[model samples]
Target chain A: MTDQASDLQEAGGQPESQDNETAATEPGVPEAAEKSGVSGKEVVLARDVSKVYGSGHAATTALRDASVHLHEGEFMALLGPSGSGKTTLLSILGALLTPTSGEVTVSGTDITELTSKEQSRFRANRIGFVFQNFNLVPFLTATENMLIAAQFASVPKRQAQDRADRLLEELGLSELRNQIPSQLSGGERQRVAIGRALMNDPDAILVDEPTANLDTKLGTAVVELLAREIKGRGKAGIMVTHDVRMVEFTDRTVEILDGVVCC
Target chain B: MGLAWKEMLRRRGRFLSVGIALLLINLLVLFLVSQLTGLDEGQTGAIRALDSDLLTFDAGVDQSLFRSSIPVSDVQEAEAVEGVAAVGPVGILFGTGRTEAEVVPDELFDMSVFGYEPGSPGEPAGLVEGRLPRAGETGVGTIDETVKSDGVEIGDTVYFAESDRPIEIVGFVDDSTFQLQPTLWVELGTWQELLAVVRPERVGSEPTANVLAVDVDPGADPSEVAREVDSSLPGTETVTVDDAIAALPGLSEQRQTFFTIIGMTYLAAAIVVTLFFALITLEKAEQIGILKAIGARTRSLAGSVLVQGLLLAIPAFLGAAAVTVLIGATLPPELPFAIDTGAWLTVGIVTVSVAVIGALLSFRRISRIDPANAIGGTGD
Candidate 1:
């Protein structure tokens, strides 16, 4: 067993021998491929990535020669305290921020070399992001928010509407599809945001504290729903969180501290 | 465009407030423009309608019609100048007139007395109701149709307040207003007699004329003839008819004042629009970051803002134009309000262009939004 998986099981107070069986049969958790019969392919590869802000005396290093990889059909949890570079690594992986020095390959494209404009296009087409605050546009209804992703991808209006409707229905938000974010509850708004993230059928999803605004019961339920969607569609996901209790819902957990990966 | 429409719909109150302010501003500007146009036409329409190309007056008079005087000898000299086709002496005097009817009191109305030679080009055209006055006709005059409003008609005798001399109304002319006053056309001999009586000091001097309306020969440049006439007749100045109208006392100054007010109103409207959109963009900064992080291009977002501005501004401009036209049409003739399609078109174009420019100014903020802020980090 990998040291990270062993640590995750220990943190959850589960025996190491039962980790594989528990992950495979949890209904929403995907089987840990290293132990299960299935072998997953790597979809996101980052090598020796480093990000530095400012310069000279004012320079602050956010990431220092850190590396990570995400595999298809795997739901990984990124655990770290404040200012530990977890968000920076996730941003670089999602193409929202550029690494000062590194190589990042996602879905067969070296995103680290892409220009700013090209990176935006790459994010639109290949990666989806769910912000911690459930950043659905306040002016748009849930359906419109979901369709915005497809619209940016240049999907035909009719087809985009159809996909948006299907995603909303699958997320059990059909009744609230026409409600603006202000009118929806915290849990409902997060679901709409997740629906928006999946509208373009992106190759990978980057979630930043998706349950930060919810209660414990609701947060666990939301994360379980995300894990089920990620594994069922065979899409890679890297969820950043500080909640160790939520690690049980993920296949692997990696910890970071002080600009360096510890596990 | 879709996003823009939805945002406007969602925040209709805010957008509507801007639209209402713009509408009121545009309405005020259009009304002022109409009034200025009407006042200009009222003050100079008769002079502009003259068939002659230029007018000659005494030089060093600062282009004031009341201050200018040309001797009959100067008129002959102007006629002899090269390129001069025709020359006719005209005299203008402002005086009060009273009808003989008992119902009309003395000092009843103001009138501009135009004295011109019989059968001269200086005579008013479109005489709808009377014949031109003849030379040596002591008590006959042609009155404009506007005099009908004062209870005077053909064959009625109106006497000048200064001379108390009776002049019979023999004809009526249409649209012959001068200096915002009704006109009464009289023979040059009678006008000279009346002028001598009104200003007795001029009775012993040689006959003098206020101006000489000069026509240019066919295929001749009026400006060239004007220069030649000015040089030919010493102590006399010549200017094209258009220049003479512009030189009218208080006309240019009034126009400039109105234009400045209108320009400032337009500028103020643009600033209001700019501040409005800037505030809206400032409030939506977080939403903008969210959109950018979701893959929206800066161009697309900026386009949405421009579209919103145009959508708001165009409808407001059209509404203001409609209201101005309605008010102008229903106003009484004495109110001096006139609006034309050309003026409305100019207002519409300028207003929409300003609005679009204002919206574009907010684009700098949109382009600088950091998408990383939409995430949960320290917005680095």
Candidate 2:
């Protein structure tokens, strides 16, 4: 773990946030999102986020006091273990969920506070999501997968077609446009998923452990492609992963332990 | 196609299952309703063709066919009543043998034979065959005419099934039936020799006759005149034209039973369509969520789901109509199926109404799907 962390530290292509650097230099304390410079351009901010399910004492806390800020053009990795609120934070970041308390800001808009319709429109225009399970609709072809994402973005079919073509081409998959998800290889399918996430040129991309199913070589390549291509577009990306190897490709590393950040 | 429609259609086996069920329900409803409506029209037409107004019968005699008879003098007595116009005496009987084409009429039906006085108000309007019967000749019914079915032509001699008397075919009219039997009209005087002889206690007096049909004056109240006529007769009942028609042997009861059957079938079809749509909505929860997540309006989604339910139902309705036409074509006239504009319109309205009701179930389920669950979050 230590060796991989060091190699990842050099190869990860990102520095810790200014506050994270300070905290790392000193070590040992629980810090909130405000204290973590973590390239804080404020693309995404969760102020005192809390999500509780059920009622009474039996109620479970999925996220408590979870706060974050994703910056513009920065590739940030959310490092954690299994059941450590990785997916929960991504949902909040993508505007797919509402926090029980506090607010989430995406693209200068407070998403959790938006009406259901406004929230939908906001997510459609500004947020992109990647799931660890490669959640491309199985019935759709690779090109159609991109087209469908563009559909939710409310782009006209003609323009969506053009964007879908460009994205598939950029993903090195122009030739596999007609293949369904099941027909594509593991890495090819993941590339298709990335193209789908990038189809509408959203302001930010949220990936929930994208490489959890891939081997080290493939996962490394996925991380490299997302970080380089995503940042090149002047868009921020927040990836939730337990894999230390992802640190090489990211612009910053955020260590989250037990719903709080550890610097 | 929308994704919801595409997904439902893509599953061929399931589509076929739902479609087959709908087809059966539709067919049942269509055939049953058509039969019910047809009977109503047929009974009315049959009554209309007789061309009579008010009728006087024995007070509280069992029913019209088995009604107690009154004297022929009762006609003059009714005609004397204020507001009553021409009054005529009529009698009915049946005999069957061979038709003009040599087909055994008895094997086909128990043909009815009605006898009416000359210039009687109760005469059938017209005929399909030759002419009205003369005093010396026999007259045949209209339903068996060659113009109707085969070569049972006017002026052709037809023999009674068991009686030795043979009659010449006469002109036939549409919808002339009594006691569910198609009528062959003969002159009233000829019928007396065949059906009655002098009674011992009432020797030399004219034998009992069926009833007196009273036609009201142009601006007169027939029911009131009929009541006056009843007061004049010692033991008799007065009924309006409609009441007399209803009293016909078995027409009303038969029609009522058929209508009940049809109503039940329509309800059954509605239930089946509703059940299928409910199951379909349940299966599509995840897809519904995806739509919700992507900002599909609840109304639009519900409308599309309803549109699918309608799509499934419309074809079944068409199938039902087709089957109704096929079945209506084969029934014998004795069955009195009145397939007409009213019946068809009723069926069309029912089909749409039931389909709309069936689709409402899916609408509720779609509205409740959370957009968050569609994104594969914590919700199931």
Best by lDDT: 1
Please list the residue runs of candidate 1 whose C-alpha ends up more than 4 Å from where it truly belongs after superposition: A1-39, B72-76, B101-107, B125-157, B168-175, B187-190, B203-207, B377-380
> Tens digit of lDDT per residue, candidate 1, span A1-263?
24322222222221223233344444432223332344466888998999999999999999998888887768899999988999999989998899999899997799988887887788788888888888899989999999988887788999899878877766777878889999987777877888888888887889999878767776776787777666655578999999999999799998988788767
DockQ of each: 0.43, 0.19
Among all windows of 10 consecutive residues in model 1 chain A, the one with the lowest summed lDDT is: A7-16
Q: Estimate each model's TM-score.
A: 0.88, 0.75
Residue pairs in clash, model 2: A11-A248, A12-A247, A12-A248, A17-A38, B38-B338, B96-B161, B127-B172, B128-B172, B130-B154, B146-B150
| Tens-digit lDDT track of model 1 for B1-380 | 79999999999999999999999999999999999888887788667645578988789998777777887656677778999988888887887777854435544788888888776657667688979798667679998787787778999998765676789999988667787777888888878878877766655568887888898899999999999998888778889888999998899999999999999999999999999999999998988888888888889999999999899899999999989988988997776666757877898899999899999999999999988777774422
Displacement of residue A57 (Cα, Å) in model 2 is 3.7
The prediction achieving the highest TM-score against the true structure is 1
Task: Report, in order, each candidate's fnat.
Answer: 0.61, 0.18
